[model samples]
Target: MYRLLIVDDEDIITDGLYEVFNRYQPERLDVCKAYSAKEALDWMSRTRIDIVLTDIAMPGMSGLELSEEIQKYWPRCRVVFLTGHSEFEYAYRAIQMTN
Candidate 1:
């Protein structure tokens, strides 16, 4: 099963994502939700997360920082960012850094 962690500061977005994933749970995927980067990190430290879907403009630690940390610890983990059009440059830089 593919384990997915969805991180966003907004509860509604996380809840909506969980609901959507739960509705169409193909490939036996498991979804977990976190409201902030800190929360996501805490959960990840104890669990084996296959994929991290995070927002770029979070309050404390940005998704870029989280993605870097995840790569350092879990090199094989996939990190996907959710960003606004204004944050395209940041996302581009992050993608470039990873490559």
Candidate 2:
């Protein structure tokens, strides 16, 4: 089973993704949710996360920063960023960092 952590400041996004993943792939994935980058780090400290789906423009630590932190500890972990922002700069920055 893969451990997936979904992080978003918005309760709805986290809850909705949690529901969808659980409903669709309960046997394949163990899904967890965090409302902030801090909470996601807390989860990471306790458990081994295989993948993280996070919002980019969070209040405290942006998803990009969180990704860097994750890479330090879990170098093989995969990060998928989610953002409502349509700005080209956000996409460009994310792509640059991943490369």
lDDT winner: 2
lDDT of 2 by residue, 27-81 (tens): 8999999999999999999999999999999999999899989989888899999
Query: How would you encode candidate 1's per-residue C-alpha lDDT over 1-99 as one tens digit per residue?
Result: 989999999888889988898677666898999999999999899999999999888899988889989989899899988876585688687789578
Clashing pairs in 2: none
RMSD of each: 1.4, 0.8
Off by over 4 Å in 2: none
lDDT of 1 at 39: 97
- Please give the distance, in angstroms, between residue 16's alpha carbon in candidate 2 and its true position after superposition: 0.6
Error of 2 at 17 (Å): 0.8
| Model 1 deviation from native, Cα RMSD in Å | 1.4
Model 1: how far is 27 from its true place, Å? 6.1
TM-score each candidate: 0.91, 0.96
Q: Report lDDT (Cα) of residue 15, candidate 1.
A: 93
